[model samples]
Target: MYFVKKSIVIVIGSILISLGINLFLVPYKVLDGGIIGIGLILNYLWGLKAGLTIIVLSIPIFIIAWVSYRDYFYNSLHGMIISSLFIDFLKTNDSLFLINPVYSSILGGVLVGSGIGLMLRFRTSTGGTDLIAQFLCDKTGINVGILIFFIDSFVILLGGILLSTDTLFLSVITIMFVALTTSLFTRNVVQA
Candidate 1:
């Protein structure tokens, strides 16, 4: 029962993440942080596949997880792979909702954040920088959400520098929503 529940959560979470990216973020070229942000950057710059890029970029992070946190490696590897596959398979050219970019960004962030948060609650995650954040959380006694926020903000800054002023502004908003939603979801749960 526990394994089934975890699998369901992972699938739902992966779907939400993929939908948010394809339906909202990709349309406006807005970004979420961490590996997703890097994936988006590469997608924008070179038409690379974001899912594939995420997998490729995650290699070193997974190695770290394998070495230091064996449980995390097992917990998150499937979520990460599933989410990446979902992302590559589901493609959308433009915003399906026809909302303005600001609203679009907010919704996108919410969905993505919710997905990430849901899996996290189950002790499974879409490993990327998330793996690093978890490791740090275990080491420093700091809240994982705050660590995610800082890492996300750094990525947003990178996106801003590499992309456009508009992208910078929108990405900042996106990451804020992502952080808030993620924190809310994880508020009462003891980190796993």
Candidate 2:
């Protein structure tokens, strides 16, 4: 039962993440933090696959997780791989589902946030910078959400510097949604 429940949650969360990326964030060339943000920036610069980029970029973070928080590493590794693969494989096939930037941002936030929350509730994560945030939270006594916000903001800034102003603006919006949604989703877990 536990396995089934966890799998279902992972599936739903992965789908929401993919939708958030494909339907809204990627279309606008926005960036989020962690491996996802790196993937977006790379995608913008070299027209690479975001999912592949995410997987490739996650290596170092995963190594960090392995060294610092083995339990977190165990829980999140699968979520990260599945989510990245689905986001890359599913979203790349089409571009017919675009929506308004504001609405997309909101929806993306809600879905991604809820998905992340669910995963966190199960003692797992989306597995990118999340592990780093957890590591920082454990070591520094800072809130994970705050750590995530700071890290993501840096990534957004990087996007701004490397890309056009329009991409920078979009990246800001994307980071906003990611921050809002992630916070909302993790409210219960973080509180606990």
TM-score of each: 0.97, 0.89
Tell me the tens digit of each residue's lDDT in model 2 across 149-184. Answer: 788888878888998777677766666666677767
lDDT of 1 by residue, 1-192 (tens): 999999999999999999988898888889999999999999988999999999999999999889988999999999999999999999777557878999889998899989988998898899998778877877887767778889999988998899898888989888888888887877777854
Q: What lDDT would candidate 1 get against the real structure?
A: 0.89
The TM-score between candidate 2 and the true structure equals: 0.89
**Highest lDDT: which candidate?**
1
Error of 2 at 153 (Å): 0.5
RMSD of model 1 against the true structure? 1.0
lDDT of each: 0.89, 0.76
Q: For model 2, what is the alpha-carbon lDDT of residue 60?
A: 83
Model 2: how far residue 166 lies from native, Å: 1.8
Model 1 is weakest, by summed lDDT over 10 consecutive residues, at: 90-99
